[model samples]
Target: MKKSLLALTVISTLLPLAACQTASNQVATAQTAEIDDKSEALKLNELTQQYFEASLARNPLMATFVGVHQYDDKFNPPLSAEFIQETRAFEQAYLDKVNQLDASELTGQDWLSYEIFKYDRQHALAGMDFNQEYMPLSQMGGAHTYFAMLGSGQSAQPFNSTQDYREFMQRARGFAEFMDSTIIFMQKGVESGVVLPRPIAEKVLPQLSSHVVEDITQSVFYAPLTKLDSLENLTSEEKSTLQQDYVAVIRDVIIPAYDRVYQYMKNDYLAGTRSTVGLSALPDGNEWYEHKIQTHTTLPLTAEEIHAFGQREVKRILEQMTKVKDQVGFQGDLQEFFVHLRTSDEFYFDSEEEVIEAYTKVKQKIDTRLPALFSVFPKADYEVRAVEPFRAASAAGASYQAPAPDGSRPGIFYINTHNLKAQPKFLLETLSIHEAAPGHHFQIAIQQEVEGLPQFRKFNNYTVFAEGWALYAESLGKEMGMFEDPYQWYGRLVDEQLRAMRLVVDTGLHAMGWSRQQAIVFMLNNSSMSETDVVAEVERYISIPGQALAYKIGERHIRELREYAEDQLGDKFDIRAFHQQVLVDGGIPMPLLTEKIQRWVASQR
Candidate 1:
C-alpha cells in the first residue's frame, strides 16, 4: 500500500499553471476526492452487509448460535439437492461481485476483508464438487443431533417466551421433514454407492431410538414443556394449552421422525451401508478426502503429507512423554506406562460429581493464573459443567461452546463425565485450559466482541485456527507456571499426542484405507485413552474426515510463528503482545495468520 511521492513544488515552468487555480478551489478538489474515497469504502461495506444477511438466511442455526434470533425458527432443507444447487449459485454470484471490487483502492481491514471474502466464496464453491449430502446424519453430529440439544432447552434456542416455544414446535415439523429428506438423500447414496460405513450406522441406531420414549414427558423434546410454568406472563390455561401442543408435537411429529430414521437406519440403510470405513471405498473418495483436508486446515496439504507430519509429531511427543515417565521413575517402557496410567485407580475418580468437582477446581486454578500469560480476557465468563447425558457418550471428554454475543448466555465448557475413569484426574490442567479460559473461550469470545471487522470475520471460523489455538493454549501451561505435577505434564503430552495421532488416524482411516479397528488400536497403543473413549474418537474421525487434523496442524503452525517471533525479537518480545497480535484478528487462514505475524515481528524490529 506504500505510494511513491510525486512532488508538487513550484518551478519556473509551472508558474502559469499555478496561477490558473485559487487556494479555495484546490481545497474543494481535494475534499471531493476524499469524499469519493469514503463513498467507495461505504459501497464495499454495503456489499459485505448484503453478503452477511444472505449467509445468515442460508444458515439460520448459525445465526442463533451467534445470538441473531431472527432465524431461530428456520432450518436449511437438510442438504436437499435443490438446496445444494441454490448454495452453489449463491456463492458463485457473490464471488463474482466481490471479484469486481477494486483492490487497489482498498486498504487496512477493508482490503483484508475483501481478500477473505473472496477466499471464503472460492473455498465454498470448490466444496460443492463433493457429494457430502449423501451421508447427512452421523452419530458424530448432524441436524438431528443438534436439534435434540436445542429441544432440550439447554442450548442456544431460547425457551422463555411463548413465541420461542412455538418456534421450536415449528422447528420440530421442519426437523421431521429434514429427517425425511435425509432418508431420501441416503437412498440416493445407496443408489450412487456413497453410503455410510456399517459400524457408524450402527452407532447411530441407538441415538435415534433413544429419542422414541413411550412417555412424552421423558423425551428430550419435552424439556420446554417442563419450563412452561416459569413463563409467568402465561395464564394457566395458556400454559396448559402450550403443554398439550408441545406433547402432541413430540408424540406425533418428533418421536415418529426419530423412529422413521431409526427404522430406515436399522432395517434399510444398515443393510445398504458399506462394511468398509474409509471414504476411499466409494467413488472419487480420495479426492473427497483431499478436499476435506483443504477445507478444515485451509492448506493445500494432501492426506499423505498430513499423515507423515502426524507420524513425526507422534514420535517427537512420545520422546517428551518418555522423559516425563523417567522423571516419574516409572520402570516400564512407554506403552507399559500408558497401560499403568489407564488402569491405575490412583489417577481416576469413581463418581461423576467428583470428576466435575475436579474439573471445576482446574478452572478456578487456571482463572487466577491466566493474567500471567494473557493480557486479554473474555467479558462473558464461562462455567465448567458436565456434558448433557444424551450426547455425552459420543462427545469428547471435554469440549467448549462460546458465549452468546449478546451476553444472554455464558460460554459452556462441558466435561463429559459419562465414564469417570475416562476423565482422568491428571489430564485436568491441560483439558481445562484447552476447553475453557485462555483457549477456546478466549479466542472465540474475543473474536465475537472484536469491532470494525466484518460480521463474517467476527463470527466465521476456519477451525484449524480455533482448535489449533486451543491446542496451542494447552502447551502454554508451563509458561503460565503450571504443570508442577509430572502427571499433569504427562496429561499435556497425552492431549498433544491425541491431536498428532488425529493427523495419522484420520488420514489412515479415510485415505490409506485403514479399517476402524486399526485406527482404534493405533491410538490405544500410542496413548493412555481408555478403550471406550478410543473407539468413540476413532468413530468420530470416520464420521468426520479431515477435521481432526486441524488441531495438530494448526497448533504446529501457530507455535512455529510464535517461535519465529521469539527468536527474531529476543529481549524485545512481549509474550502478552505476541498473543494479542495472533488473536487480534479472529480465526483466519493459516497462511494469512503467518503473514500477519511476520509483518508484526518486522514492525517490532
Candidate 2:
C-alpha cells in the first residue's frame, strides 16, 4: 500500500480546569488558562515546524518534490544502517520534545496538530521497528525506480538551472552509493531469510538492465543533458562541461552502478530469493504483515475479517452485476457476460489518443457536475497523461499525482496505455472520476490547500482515506446521473469488484498460503477483470502486503459514515456540507474521521 509522509495516533483529552470558589476567582482562573493555552499552542506550533524542517532535511527527495529546494542538492541513501539509526534517533528526539509540550490547553487546529504529531512520531517509531531495509527495493517501487523517474526529465526534479545540473550530478553520486548500500542489504537478506521472492527478483532484472546501456546517450540518466538549452547563463564551454559531467556519470557511475546490481540480482540474489511468494514465507513475516494491515487501514482489522468482508462485498456487487446483465439483455449468464465484457473489443480502447480524449471528456463533464454534490473543489485542475514509457508496463492501470501546493504543477492522472485491455471502455467514467476530479485530485489538492494546517497533515497521506475516498467517489457516478446505461453501471461494479477482490487476494497471499496462480485465478473467477489486469493487480499485492485492503476498508467506513449522516439528519442532511466535513480536514484516520462527521451531524441536528 502507498503511505503518506505522516501517521496519526491518540486523541488528546481536555485537562480539567480549576473549580472556582467565587465569580471573581472563576474569572481569574479563565484569564490564567487563556495565557497558558496561548503559550502552549505557540510552543506546539514551533515544535511542528521544527520537526517538519528536520524531516525535510532528512528526506531531501521528498523536500525536492514538495518545493523545498534547499535540499535539492542533498541525497541520502535511505537503506543504510547509519541512515536508519539516525532516522530512529531523529524521530525519537523530536517525539520526546513533543511529549514535553502541554497538550491540555491546545484546542482547534493546535490540538489536532499536537495529536497528529504525537501519532506520527509514535507510529513511525513503531513501523521502523520492522527490518524493512532488508527487503527494500521491489520491481513495483523503491529508490531504483524513483531514481530512474527523477532522471527522466518528466518528474518533480527540476533541470532548470546550472545549480540544478550540479545538484543532479551530486544526486547521481549518491545513487551510486545507494546501489552499494542496496547490495549490502541484499547480502544481509540472503544471510537471513528476508530476501525478495524469486519472481520479484526476475521481474526486477529487466528494469535494472534497462538502465545499463553500452551507448551513453541511451541512458535515462543522460536525459537531462539533452535539455541543457533550458539553462540560461551557461556559455558553450559551460554547457560542454556539463555535458561531459553527465556523460561521465552515465558511463562511469550510473550505468556501472546499475550493471553491478543487475549482475548480482541475476547471478547471485536470484538463487537466494525465496521460492514461496508470501510474506508468511519469511521470519516474523506474519507480524510485519499484521503491522502493515493496522498501519494502512488505521483500524484494528485482521486479514480474516477483511477477507470475509471482501467476500460479502463481492457477492453484493455480483448481485448488482446480475441485474445489470439482465438489464442490458445480454444473451448469456453472468459469467458469460463477464467473458463477453473482457473479450469484446467494443469495451476496449483502440489507441492511446482515444483513451486520453475519453478522460478529457470525463474531466469536462465531471467538473461541471461536481457542484451539485460538492461545495469545495480544488483550485488546481488535473491533467490526464500517459504513464511514461519506461515504467508504463509495470505501473498501475491509472494513478494520480497531487498538484503542487503553490500551484506550480497541476495534478497528473496517469493512465497506463501500455495495456489497453486494462483500460476497458465501459469502465472509463468510473476510472476517470476515481483517479481525477473529486477523487485523488480533489482529496490531495484540497489537502495541500487546507489553510493553516500543519505541513504533515497537509502532505501526509493515509492510504485508507485517500484510496477509500476515491473508491467512494466512484460510487457517486449514479448520484451524478451518469452510468445510466446498464453496461456503464456494470463498469462501476467491475471497478468496485477490483477493490473488493483486493481485500481477499491480499489476505490470501500473505495469510492463506496461496500460490501466485491461486490468487490470480481467484480474482479472475470473482470479477470481470481481464486476466492481464488481474495478474498486474495480484503481483502488486504480492509486492506490497496489506496496501490493497485500504481501498475497500476505507471506502466502507466513509460510506457507512455517509449513510449514518443521511439516516440521522433525515431531511436536514446537506450532501455538500457532509462532503466538506469529510474532506476539509484533509486525510484523517478512520476513527478521527468518524468522530468528526458525527460531531458535524450532531451540530446540524
Candidate 3:
C-alpha cells in the first residue's frame, strides 16, 4: 500500500533555495555572503506553506483526508506512463531547487525541516526508477480497497452535507477514470513481466467480484444514498436529487468500472501473473529489494546482515520461551508445547465480540498504568474496531489508522478476526499495547497534536520509527505491570519472536531465493504463530518486500538509546522525560532519533 497522502505531504512542504550560479567567482561570492538565518527561516516557512497549498490543489482525495476541504471534488489523472514520467520530472525539479540550499546556514528545526524535505524528494525520485506504477493494484492495498472504504460512510471521506454528497458524485466519476487507467497499467505490466504474484491476483478477483452486485442499493458505492436522511442541511428535494444522482452513478459508472476490472483480472491478467513469490524474480529485483530495505529501515544493513541478526534473535527468543515452558511445567518438547498453545480452547476466543471485548478490557487496565511511564499524552482518544469482513482474510493480525488531524475522527486499532484461532488469548496484552495505548495511537496522536512543526512533520511516517516504537511499546508491558501471568509473559515472547522471524523470512524470500512455502515453514518451526497466521504473514512479506524488517530493527535501536540514557544518567534518569524527548519531535529517521536522544543526554549532564 502507498503511504497515507497525509504522510506523503512531506514532498509539498519543502522550501526551494535561490537558483545557483555556475561561475566560480559568483559561486565564491554566494557561499561567502552573510545570510540572515532568521530571515531565511521565515522565507523557508512561507515557501513550505505555499508548497503545501500547491500540493493540495493537485491531490484532492489527500486534501479531503487531511481536512483541507477546498479540493474535495477533485482527483488526479490515472497513473499512466505519461503521468508517471511527468510526476518524476516534477519531483526532480523540486529536488534540484532544494539542493541549492546550504544546510550549514540553517539551525534547529529549520535545519531539521530542510533535511526531511531533501530526504523525501530524493527518496521519491529514486523510487521512480522502479516500475511500481505498472503493478498499481495489490490484494494488500489498492485503489479498489481504498475506494470501497472511502465510499462505505465509515472512513475519512465526510458525508455531512448535500455538498459533500455532490462532491463525492464527481469523485465517483474520477474513480471510474482511475480504474480504467489501472487496466491500462496492468496491460503494460503484462508486456513487461512486472505483474503481481499469482496468489495475490487470485485474491484480488474475489474482492473485485464482491462489489459487482445486481442491485444498485446493495453496492458499497451506493452507500451515500442510505446516509442522505441523516444530513440536516439538505432539503427534501435536494436529498431526492442527490439520491437520483447516486443511483445513476453507481449503476452506470461505478459498477461497470468494477466489472471491467473484474473481467480483465479473471480472463487476462491471471495468466500473465508470476508464480515466483520473491521480488528477486523480477527485473532489477536485487536493486529494488535493496532500496526497499534502506527505505523501510533507514539503516545501512544489507540483506545478509539482517538475515544473520534475525537468526541470532530467533535463537535467543527460543531460550526465553524454553524458560517459560519450564516454569509452567509443560510436558513434551518445545514443538509439542507449540501445539498445546495452538489447540488449547482456553487460548481461543469464541466470537469476534469476545475478541473485541478482551482488547477493551486490556485498554481499561493499561489506561491507569500509562501515567507512570510517559510525561506526555495525546489529546486525541482512540477506539478499537474489528477489521471489516471484506479485507480481513488477507489483513494483518492487527493494524492501526492514525486519527484525523482535525480530531473529527479518532485513531482506530483494527483487529482481524478472520480466523479467531490466529488470535491467541495470550497475545492480547502485547497486541493491545502495541496497536493501542502507548503504541501507535500514543505516538501518532502526539505527533498530530505537536505545535509549530510543519504539517508534513505532523502527518508523515517513517515505517521504522512508527512500527519500531510500537514494538518497543510492547516491551513496556513489564514496566506497566500487565504481564504478571507467566502465559502473558510468554505472549510477549511470541510477539517478539514474530518480529525476529520477519527479519529472517523477509530476507530469506527476497534475497536468499527461498520459496513462499520455505518462509512459512521457517516461521512455524521457530514460533508459536498459527499456520494460518504464519501463511498470511509470509504472503504479506512476499507482497510487500522489506516492510517486515522494520519492526525488530527499529525496536533494537530504541531499546539501545534507552539503555544508553540510563547508563549515562544513573539515578537521574527519568523514564517519562526520556519518552517525552523521544516522542515530542514526532516520527523521524532512526539516526536522527538517536542524535536527538544523545543531545538530550548531553544537556542533562
What is the clash count for each candidate, in the order shown?
0, 2, 0
Q: Per-prediction RMSD in angstroms?
A: 11.7, 7.8, 5.1
lDDT of each: 0.79, 0.78, 0.80
Model 1 Cα lDDT, one tens digit per residue, 255-342? 9999998998888988898989998888998888888898779987888899999999999999999999999999989889988998
Of 2 and 3, which scores higher on lDDT?
A: 3
lDDT of 2 by residue, 391-500 (tens): 77677788877666788888888888998988888887888888887788889889989888888777777788988999899989988877887777888898899889
**Deviation in angstroms for 90 in model 3?**
2.2
For candidate 3, lDDT tens digit of each residue in 335-400? 999999998999899999999999999999999999999989999888888887766766678877
Q: Which stretches of candidate 2 lie over 4 Å from their true place?
A: 1-38
Clashing pairs in 2: 1-547, 4-461
